[model samples]
Target: MSTSIRVIEAVKSVNVQGSPAHWANEQGTRFKNPWTSWREHDWRDMYYILFKHNRLTPKAPENMSTLLPTRKPTWNHEGDDAQKLKATWIGHASFFVELPARANTEGRVPKRGARILFDPIFSTHCAPIKLAGTARITPPACALEELPEVDAVVISHNHYDHLDRPTLTKLAALPRKPHFFAPLGNLAQLMSVGVPQDNCHVLDWWQSRRVEVDIPSQDGSDKTVPAVFDLTCTPNQHGEGRTPMDRMGYPKSLWASWVAREVLPDLSSTSPKTVYFAGDTGYRAVLDEQNEDEGPVCEAFKQIGEKFGPIDLALLPIGAYAPRRFMSTVHCSPKDSALVFKDIKAKRAIAMHWGAFILTTEPIMEPPKKLKEACEEVGIEEGAFICTDIGQTMLYD
Candidate 1:
């Protein structure tokens, strides 16, 4: 810890007695939304926007490179202060996170802590047919081949924007393929993308796995030693499906937020540093279930906070929420994101799911701007929640 670095008072997490059973039913045929009875909008709803509220679609920013600035990842892969954790925003809900490494580091190549990737989708377009899909407006942090050895890869859900088959296939083909994790009912999809069944983890909410990876020995020996990390599938308010059949009120597959915790020498103890990813979610039922803007906030985040409070860092969505009456049921507005940061009790947070693809009607730069307003409205400390350049790497102690 650096003397100059200030942090919020640590909030101890209260233990949760049992796994939340509201996530997926025993039959697994359908998933439930415990918070609200959501009414799914059909193509007919689009007519409402077209005929009644025809707002011109926002254009991509001309100075995107400057407005949504970026820099090549600058942290040394191996010698980076192990006590300092690094997060690289890989554009739009995609991030590469390295847990705090063991005190000492040793390697010719960059070797950070157990490296983990979240919702990595590097395609030019986020759709089944690339040519006719939403094109990526900003470039990814780095080329897929340039990423270092990854220990684990977690997908927030099966949305085309979050889960790209080609990208996963390429990663799975790497010599040192990573362990792939997703919410329940996604094992077959991961395998279809070349992830070995032995390396894929499809978990229900609250389920956790202790995965181990090899890191170069601190003794400077060419040999390596094993390090462990815990990957937990936590609850989120979202839905998943790729095709028409996969959708119809109930979720066809589970979607989840993830929590990654570092394992210290004493594996029995809890992690000193934890990271939470709110893949994609709506904080409350609005527009769809409630006509009013204010609604009952989802209890999932509070439960998540109870189990993993005082989170070191959190990546939350602050984009794609436009036509609040329509999109508020699925995506989070910047204000909603601010509440999520509070609900999770994160020490620090970075804004994502914006400045990349134009998934909705908001202006390209609107999310970050709105987030600033939201944070101020909520009296969050300045710099506590920030937006980094698309490819920038932020370090925290």
Candidate 2:
């Protein structure tokens, strides 16, 4: 046997034991219950449906044009900016947030806010091609080495896209490994990939831990800077998985969205501007459970608004949903995203999870366009939803 084939077999063998049970029991890795239930049809069944409907556009594995590399960004800190926040889209589900420069205000400059990452997928493909049956259409927008510094990383669920092994490996090996956060059962996945325990922080739904971020004052200001900021783990309607067969139970690891805000000294009536990061949620009936438990999604938002006040910026998913019958329950389409925006009462939001990886049946450029039109129809300002190309960064002052 060839040496390369032998190596490939060895790697596959190691992972096989840890593969999800659903795939193990079925012996067919191509189908999943969640995917099937959402579609009301199996993978093969969908193929036939598409063929019959004349929607099959089977193209060769040629490189997709839009999947080109974007240029690195420049961070220019001019004048006295008040703790600026800038976000760079580093491809699918990955972003880099730049904390403002720490300047002395009171007596000392607050520790510049810690950098945080979300459901990061730095690898080329989400799932193994042998399992998913397709490779990623686009490469990651930025390589790990290119990242400035990450202080914390949040794992939304156990999906390969959200919990990529290669990405975790690279992240774990950083000179100063950032604090890793995940749901309950996910520690196993991270350990399996070689991340250490001291660096990991796991949380259940609605749980929060305060992390200190140094508050900066104007460079020449004589004021003493604050000492920290806080990050909270909120809830989301999503699922988790490592293998096809592993039914550790959906939402087992406590799938969640996140809220990050400045920590006020008083912690009294002074409300800090909130930033919500929606991590791949489908609208669930439980969303409204917070109030009288009526309108799930809307109610969830109402509580969030009351607690966090008007959101200054929200990072929400706006793609990967297609063939509505299968995706609506688990993923929100562009229109559904707009509704979520209204529910949350966020001042502005950015559309993500699109144009990075081709994980569904929708065409590449459909998400942003649809979101824009939907926002317009709803009488929202076009600028309310910011959609930029991969690697582009936007500042919310």
Give the top-scoring candidate (TM-score): 1
Find the 10 residues in a row with the least total lDDT in model 2. 1-10
What local distance difference test score does each model get? Answer: 0.78, 0.61
The backbone clash count of each candidate, in order, is 2, 21
lDDT of 2 by residue, 10-102 (tens): 111112223433222333322232222222234644564456433432332455544444656543445444356667777777766655544
Give the true-structure RMSD of model 2: 11.1
Worst 10 residues of 1 by lDDT: 1-10
The TM-score, computed over Cα atoms with residue i paired to residue i, of candidate 2 is 0.75
Best-performing candidate as measured by lDDT: 1
| Stretches > 4 Å off in candidate 2 | 1-69, 75-82, 102-112, 130-133, 213-227, 248-251, 267-271, 284-299
lDDT for residue 367 in candidate 1, whole number 0-100: 86
If scored against the real structure, what TM-score would every candidate get?
0.88, 0.75
